[model samples]
Target: MSTAVHTMNATALKGRARDLGRRVTVLMLLPSTLWFLLLLVTPLLIILVFSFGERSAVGGYAGGLTLANYLNLGSRAAAFSNTLLLAPMGTLVCLLAAYPLAYFLAVKVQRSRSLLLTLVIVPFWTSFLIRTYAWIFILSGKGLPAMLASLGLENVRLINTPSAVLIGIVYGYLPLMVFPIYVSLEKLDKRLLEASQDLGASAFEGFRRITLPLSAPGVITGVMLVFILLMGEFLIPAILGGGKVFFVGNALVDLFLQSRNWPFGSAVAMALVAIMLVVIGLYLKLVARHGGRPGEGAL
Candidate 1:
């Protein structure tokens, strides 16, 4: 009877302990939950509500139930098209440029790796706006064009052009692309490559079969990061293209700030959100097919 009583007491104590733990967890999560609701969820809800309304005669949202805002998305089709095209193109370019550099930092450099890595990110120490502004001078007629003219390639117009926007995109977002891939490659198991070599696989073959597959998660992450930001990009195009190139972000700015067309801006913002969700869904499916998770290796 004594032994049974002791076991029962211990079990009851354990149940109480679990209940206490659950309460503690809930308490810890309360602030963050409230913060998320207050900042992110609330604003998104407001935007969704406003998206269904109409623009007032003077400019802001006029509450009503209508689909006219969405129906009028055709007016800004050019901005959507430009954003869609450049975002992916810029991501691909950044990927192509970042991979080899990441590989070098991860695989080749040993003693000075930290220094080189710091050098890669050194540009981030300065203000982003300042850095972007510097490009204006560099690509202007008195900058690269002047140097090129000296070399017999005169009349090279880079500023206020799509090429200038692409260059700015690559320069600005390269670090975001590089760090993810570098981390992925850095953590890779080098012994796998040696084993493949011992098993009579050539370097390229080993890379194709082993290294590429393992590093896929990083590539996907980098692509997604760059692509998503590029989709909403405004400053680079605005500064580099000199307002000649328009993106969805630029359009949003114009609507909300300049035009004060709050309802239409809200509708556009909601559409952009939807498109991002679809793109992210497709990316997730691709990751699933390859049997890898973001920020984790296939192995």
Candidate 2:
């Protein structure tokens, strides 16, 4: 009877400990949860509400619901077109440039790997705005254009063009694309490659069958990261394109700050967020179909 009582007491103690642990976990998460509610969720809710409302005669949101703001999205069709086209193009460029460098770093470089990685990251330590501003001078008539002109290529205008924006995009986002793929390649098993070779597989065959599939997760991650950021990019296009190549981000800025069309801006912002969510969802489903987990690296 005494032993039974002792066992019951121990069980009660264990239950209390579990309760305490649950309370501690709730406490730990409380601040972040409150912050999210106070900042992100609240702001998004406000934006969503404002999106359906009317704009004041002078500016800002006016009460009462209407779809006029959404309908007016057609006015910014050019911005949408530019963003959709250039963002993907920029992502592709970054991928093309980044993959080879990442591969070399991961698969070929035997010494000073850390140093090389540091070199890739060192540029990030400087301000992005500063770096982009420098590109303005670098692409000016006196810069690369002049050097090329002296080499017999005439009238090569790079600054304030789509090409200049692409150059800036690739330079800025290459590191993001590089690191994920590098991690995937670095973690790959060499034994698999050796075994494939032993089975009479050529290098290309081995890469196509084994390496590519395994590295897909990282590739997708890099593409997603670069694509998402490019979708919202404004600075490079603003500085390099000289307002000629406008994106959705540029449109948003113009609406909010320049035009002071708060309701219309909110509608645009909400639409942008919705589009992003849809894209993310579709990409996730595609990755699921391929059985690829982002950042998992090569097995």
Tell me, by TM-score, which candidate is best.
Answer: 1
The lDDT, on a scale of 0 to 1, for candidate 1 is 0.91
Total clashes in model 2, counting residue pairs 3 or more apart in sequence or in different chains = 0
In the order shown, the candidates' Cα RMSDs to the true structure are 2.3, 2.8
Tens-digit lDDT track of model 1 for 121-167? 99999998999999999999999999999999979999998899999
* Candidate 1 Cα errors over 4 Å, as ranges: 1-4, 291-299
Poorest lDDT segment (10 consecutive residues) of candidate 2: 290-299
lDDT of 2 by residue, 1-299 (tens): 99999999999999999999999999999999999999999999999998898878888877788999999999999888888888889999999998889889998898889999999999899999999999999999999999999999999999989899989999999999999999998998889889889989899888877787777878888999999999899999999989898989999999999888888899988888888788878978977876555323322
Measured with C-alpha atoms, the lDDT of residue 106 in candidate 2 is 92
Off by over 4 Å in 2: 1-18, 291-299
Query: What is candidate 2's local distance difference test score?
Result: 0.89
